[model samples]
Target chain A: MDEFSFINSIKQHSYKQSSLIKGIGDDAAVIRQPTQDIVCAVDTLVEGVHFSRQTMEPWHIGYRALAANVSDLAAMGASPAFYLVSIVIPKTWSSGEINQIYVGMKQLATKFRMDLIGGDTVSGQELSVSITVIGYVERNKARYRSLAKEGDKVFVTGTLGDSQAGFHILTNPGYYTDEVYYKERHQQPLPRVDFASKTENISRIVFNDISDGIANEANEIAEASKVSLILYEKQLPIKDSYEQFPPKLQHKWKLFGGEDFELLGTVSNKDWNELQIIAKETNTPLKEIGYVDDSQSNIGQVFLHENKQTYRLQKKGYTHLK
Target chain B: MDEFSFINSIKQHSYKQSSLIKGIGDDAAVIRQPTQDIVCAVDTLVEGVHFSRQTMEPWHIGYRALAANVSDLAAMGASPAFYLVSIVIPKTWSSGEINQIYVGMKQLATKFRMDLIGGDTVSGQELSVSITVIGYVERNKARYRSLAKEGDKVFVTGTLGDSQAGFHILTNPGYYTDEVYYKERHQQPLPRVDFASKTENISRIVFNDISDGIANEANEIAEASKVSLILYEKQLPIKDSYEQFPPKLQHKWKLFGGEDFELLGTVSNKDWNELQIIAKETNTPLKEIGYVDDSQSNIGQVFLHENKQTYRLQKKGYTHLK
Candidate 1:
């Protein structure tokens, strides 16, 4: 297909949004300016670096790419509004495969009513999809990593290491008995947008999304906040099936594996119970993983406590530049 | 450098904007939302496709990518407010090269006070830069390709074929005498944001930025606006230097060459002189190239008149896909 036809085909996926005054037919998409504070983030998934052709279909790649950006907005307790995608396609991809990609994004975008407004489609040797999402948040209510304080309790939504475990299962199919659950997790890990919106009532919180594992994410919050975090290894929530793998392999996945798409952060001790109540009402898994401490090495550290032994969690995960 | 440190280094490029509440240190960039109607667009440039390493430097590549997106905003008569760049780096690119890229973007961004907000940095096999820019335009005042009508005078800003001539000079050095002028045009083709802003007071006009030469852009307006355009060949504006090339090459560059970064569209006859005055006051070259016509095919036709011979202009230029 020509570029114009490709663009016109994707327009079929765009749903009517009151805020958008102009869409595909214009030089640029025009929208009624928003009045609420808005947060925007971009995430790109590249072939080989992010996903393998052996493991992922075009549909899931699209879904995962959009979800990654939405997860960032969710970390700030924002509601998704609009998105634009810039995709590089290799000639090896079929036209049908590309159409499936848009269908996949449309499925996830409809969950939050995100309107696709603009994008760039170009040919390249490798496929890469970069999506930018814009979402609304209340001015002072938006959360940030630097907002965490000494007395706050660290919390995590959903189970840790689930996506990595799922990815492992996808790569090594028959080795895991429960392939369905793990494979689905790998394919369509949901962004906690609803959970974020539910917690918007809280006056203050420090939030980060579990994109590059707790080790890296925790370090980000700790470094940005200029405080330290301590996690009880026994408190980490993981699926029981993790025990089937070798012990070191099992342990490493939870602490260092990435792409969980779950929310991780700190909240006031008094507000902790209310958060759990909201999680329970919404049926989202919630766990108290650790606490922020001023007594620890204060220039931003993360320590893990297991079997009466404590050690610093290595500050690394899924870095593109090293 | 690790991802966090790499992100930290890019922090130096982020300038402060009153609308931006958070920048490099946050999970997502947050901004005090705009109050006027806003328009956004994205453009991507892939290595070997948009530029050649032998001809263009890293700095000019960055400038060209961002300028492409700003030109879209300019076409809509929007004032640029914010921009985000998602760049992919190949293993061959050094850190200093990447820093130079951002420096190139910052030079043009500072011209219109565009702020860098949020983006993704990832590793890939080929270098690609995708830039998204958001701009403010008054409600119902923004221009569109689908707004031209019969009897509207077709106009073009700046000169045509200048970028193509410059690009040729760069690739085939000693053949062209005016290297400085054409080379600058190819390296830093300015977006018509200023001219667009000056003409924002006009009640009606159709505008399309000529990134894909006038043939493609004029055809786009004709197709989108459901009209026809007839250009007088003698009225086409070009530098006297173009005659140094072969006659066919000279003619082809003006009609089919891309990357001029000029503006082309139609204006009402009564409003025509005012546009010329504005262009003159701003020292921007303006020319009346053609007129919208109802006598031709209503299904969007473009025709060129030369030496008592009139023929159709091909509907193609610089498309990434077949």
Candidate 2:
């Protein structure tokens, strides 16, 4: 379809929010933010690098792009408010395919109660979707990756490695069993927006989303907080589907195969029990797998415990360069 | 360059602001808004479509990307606060080349007092820079394209057609003289951020940025406001640099060639003189080219007047598809 037609079709899917004074159809979207602080993040997913059209549906690609940005906001304990999407599509694609992408965006946007405010759509050689999400949090209450303190217990929400397993099944469709479950996880990740309200009583919490694998994220927390993370491999909450794989393969994926979109965070030991109680009350699975140490020698380091032996992880997680 | 090193190289250049609670190196960027209302807009620039690496420097590409977003904010009459950039580059690009892009972004960011807040860096087949800019405006003061009133005088900032002319020279160097002037205009069209303050006294001002040429933008304003825009050909602000072209060629570029990045708007005839005075005081060149009309037959139409004859424009200006 032509640009005007494409824009008109998606305009029907844009939902209005009270804070949004003017959305879409304007030079810029105007919003009256209810709060003083807002969290912002952006992520771009390109064809061939983030997804393959042959392996995934257009809707799933759109869903994953927004999901990545939502996960970033979740890490900050921010409530999703509005998002802008900039999409570039190849000329060969039909208008229907483009509509499906927005359909996917509308589905998730409805769930999060966020508005599709403003963006640009253009033609390019490769299909790419870039999303900017704006979220809000209470003053001085937003979580940070650098807030993990010595003696804090590291915890994660939900099971790890599911997205990676789903990705494997998607890319190698014939090689894996339980394809539906893994593909669904890979295609649609549930951002931990519920985590913010659930753990409101817990203080001194530092959090990050697991997009670059647990090991790498753990190292990031350690480096930013100037502490060491000692993760117990046996305690990792690997998904049941991932356990079907060989132990080594499961371990590798758990540590290095990123895109899980789960919340990885640390809380002071004093508040850990309160957080666990809240998680249980909220019906969210919370796993404690490590603790932060203050030793300078181990700062910026991640140690893995397996078979009653501790080993430092020397390899970094998945890099976008690949 | 690897993602980590690339992120570090640009981190030093990132400026800090009082409203920014956190900038980069975290789950997301946190900013404190001083105003109750904020404006946001996003745009993406793709290689081969927006610019060619062979014809433009990496820094210029970066500058243009941010400039486009800034222009959008300028149209809304907001003060730019911060911006996020999502850049995708081919793996073959060197660290130095990537650094140059950030250098260009930093240069513009500094001039506008906008901080490079947060974004994603990923690999893709082609280079694309997507920027989301956040700006603040006084409550109920932001301009809208849909606010134009009948009998309102249409005004354009600076001159038009220079960018299109520059683009021609850049693509076909041998065909044009005064290459320096045109090429510079094409490479960097100054965003009219200064217009917001200059027109503060005008009670009923509607604005839009002229990225899609006068004919297209006039039609947009007409359609949005349900009015007709009548243009006086002699009143069109054709740049002196563009005057060297044949009259026909100059008119063609003025009407159909876009990327001028000038402010286009309408102010009530009663307030027009005051606006012009303020524009002169601010040292901003503002030209009155036409007036909004209340003709039902000409609703959503643009009529160009030349030599006492009026003609309708049947063709739209440059579209991304072309």
Candidate 3:
């Protein structure tokens, strides 16, 4: 299909939202702001760097792209509203393949109730999907990474390391034949939008999505908030399926693996109990793996407690830039 | 520089706006909506497709990317506000080169008072810059392509075909030594945001940016509004610099060349005189080249009047999807 036909095919998938005045078929999309503040985030996924065509389906690529941007909004405690996607694809791809990609995007958009308002598609040497999501939040209710305070507990939603293990399985095909769950985790990450809404009423809570591993994001919060993070390895919430791997690999993946799309945040000690109850009510797996502390010498330092031995945790994660 | 350092280097360039609650260095950027409605547009530029490194400077590429998206908002008569950029570059590029690209973006952003709020940078085989601009417009004042009425006078701002000629000169160096104006026009087409603002008070006006040439965009306006557009070829806004080229080349570029980034729209005969006065005060060269007519038999058709002869104008332009 040509550009116009491809746009027409996917345009039907865009749903009408009360705030959206115009979507697609226009020079720019028009949307009414439901609240005072709007949250915006952008993320790009490249063909080989973010995903390989040999290991993943086109639909999964599309789903993952939108999921990553939605994860950013989830981190900000914003309600998903609209998304603009810029897709660069090779000319050799079939129209069916392109439609499948949009199918994946439409499925996720419907689940999140987001309007695919505006975007552009162009021919390129490789496939790259870049998405920018816009959402609305009350001025005072929006969460930020710089709100963590000393003595606040660092919490994460859902199990960790599954996405990394999934990546390994996808790359080394026959190596983990029984780890279908890991592969699925990597390909289809559920953005924790529902969980974020449950904690919207709680004040002074800081949140960020774990797109670049817990260690990397932990350092970001620590530096931004002028605090230090101390993580206990024993408290890391590793999934039961992850136990099948060797302990060393499990530890590596749990601490440094990215693309989990789970929410990593901090809540004041006073609200910890209340948050736990809410998490349980919402069916969100909340785990306390670390705590914030005043920096003594090394500001923004991260400490790892493993087997009762404390060591400095290096800031490292899945980085596409060398 | 590492990803963090690279982000930090550009972060300082983000100017503070009162409506911007948060800018960069977080999971997402937050902005307070100053108006009831927001306009959003996204466009992507790829190396060797939209530009080439040998023919264009890195800064020009970055400037062009944002300019294209800004043009969309101008067409909708929206005030330029915030933008999110996603850049995918080869790992071989230097930090200085990347900084130059941001420098180009910053120059334009500063001129328009637009905030470079949030984006992601990733590694890819080739360079691609995708930008999504968010602007504000009052609900009643926003223009649409579907609002053209029969007998409305069609108008355009500034000269057309300059960008295409600039592209030619840049690619074919030394061919037009004195035509530096065309080269600059192509590399940095100014978005007609100020002109759009000047005509905000005009009622029943339809607007679109001449990015894909007048013929192509005219066809869109005709089909969208269920009308026919008849253009007098002698009224086509070809710059004096464009005369140096052969007549055939000049005619082709003026009619079919894209990326001029000028506004094209229609206003009722009553508002045309007032619009001309406003355009002059704003230093915008507004020209009437055509008129919208009731679609009697050939609905959504465009006709060209040239050399005492008239014929149907084909709907075609510079499409990257070929």
Candidate 4:
């Protein structure tokens, strides 16, 4: 079974719906929305670059593709819908492993009610998977990345860099691997869809997923929005195991390492309490990291104050291409 | 500029319409289609597996990705609308070449009005381009590969094996590149979108694109439709250059080499003249190649008779894995 056959077999078990005009074999899967418009996104994951083929599980590989793309829709304040997947795998890979990947993707798709519309398959030297997810959002309520303003408080969901810390645990056993929090955060980063829908007033906030780590993502928002962002170094959230590391390494990994997939947004200071309320209602943590500043900031450098000394925090982020 | 920057530049130039809820920068680009369902498909072209990176221009590489996916949509009789692209390039390649590829895709997208949406870019050892194209089709007009019957006359629009001929011309040069008809067919494939749209009575026809040569595609339709297909050797149309080749080589290239991207369908005999009328109206040729037969009668073989001897055509079709 090639990748195409594996996808087909999973699609074969999809619940038949009249709204799906065409599914799983065309250029695109056509899903009808008599009263709604379609929301969509595309994500690509490559072996060695996105995941180490030697250590990555087929299920996790499949799960992350769906999760990462769906998180994009969530950031846009949209609901999940159908998706098309394109996969290229080495011909030598077994069909059984490919099937397990689909099995993993199907678990998520089923939970999310995502229709596996259509995609293409071909043989290649390395594994590459690209998924285009289509969802729906009210035209009036779609989110944007250029909405944050001056005096906005920077907000991030859940613990920052937990995923990165999880990576370290998985990679170096001498650090911390047996801890449930670290392992789960690394293997399965939850997309904050529930938190997104609950926070309506924050829709206009500059939003990004911490796939590239909070430090880099914060800088992205600052650069794109054309504002200086001040991250409080001491207030920065770090896993307990991460704190046990040498100060230099801890700061480096937490600030620069990515793969967190957590939501980061900036809201006006006035909405801080309201933001907390929404997070409470959704039972999701919305951590306040710092503030959007007007200083002549040099991109993503953080400010630290320690023992009668002030220091600049340089970017210590993950670099995929490097 | 890197691959990401080049792709980002392409996304930046995409037109923003009210119908497009989200354009780029997110995981996916979301669009609203009031009541119409969307058709989507993806196709990936690798450096050597799909095209020779050394000879093929970047623009053609981009064009082929869009064209191939567009061809798939045409097979489903879906209207072309939007597409997302993901590409991986080697470190040694220049960003200028990558931008040129996007320029190629932009030209096609501009011509077709298919919205250029979102994608991902990464550095890799070999170049690979993947495009997911989305379109819309009425619920009732969508076509598939499972509708052919025993009595259906198999037809292919335009000429067959021209891509293989083109490949030969470009690779070997001494073949057919000298002939204008063969040269253009090899370099610029005219997808049968016009012919596909005119395929009325689609409910009674099995549909697919002839990418992997007609013989291989016939086998695919045969396998999907659970029927055997027989091609009349005399009825197979060829250009002048094809005849110049050795007889055995001519048949072999036409039967096994793929990437023609033409519309190949099988229709009931009753709709034959009507199809011809539609073809004439559209100024496209729908040539009759063979007939569908009982699976038990011939298995998966194409039959041809020369003088008094009957011979079975071997499955010499191009395999991506191979």
Question: How close is chain B to the truth by TM-score, in each candidate?
Answer: 0.86, 0.85, 0.86, 0.81
Q: Write the per-residue lDDT of candidate 2 for residues A13-120, one digit (tens) a residue.
A: 332233433333311223445553467788888888988887679888888888888888888777777777788878777767776777787678778777666667
lDDT of 4 by residue, A216-300 (tens): 6676566556676666666666655666656776666567767777787888877788888988998887788877776654443
Winner on lDDT (1 vs 4)? 1
The TM-score of predicted model 4 comes to 0.80
RMSD, every candidate, angstroms: 10.5, 10.5, 10.5, 10.3
- Per-residue lDDT for A228 in model 4? 63
Give the runs in model 1 whose Cα sits over 4 Å from its true position.
A1-34, A317-322, B1-34, B317-322
- Per-residue lDDT of candidate 3, residues A110-212 (tens digit): 7877766567778799889999887766656767777888899999999999898898887776756448788888988889888886777788888888887
> How many Å off is the CA of B118 in candidate 4?
0.9
Cα lDDT tens digits for candidate 1, B1-322: 3323433332324332344432333112233455555567778899989898887898999888889888888888877877777888898987667767777887898788776655667889999999888777776667878789999999999888888888888888685677798999988989998888788778998888888788988887887788889888899998877788878777878888878888998999999988988898878899999999976544587888877877777566322211
TM-score of chain A of each: 0.86, 0.85, 0.85, 0.79
Write down the lDDT of every candidate, Cα atoms only. 0.77, 0.74, 0.77, 0.67
Model 2 residue runs over 4 Å out of place are: A1-34, A173-178, A314-322, B1-34, B174-178, B314-322
Calculate each model's fnat, 2 decimals: 0.40, 0.40, 0.41, 0.36
lDDT of residue B81 for candidate 4? 69
Question: How many steric clashes between backbone atoms does each model show?
Answer: 0, 0, 0, 22
User: lDDT per residue, candidate 4, B32-101, as tens digits?
Assistant: 4655435667778888788776547887777777887788778877767666677887776677777778
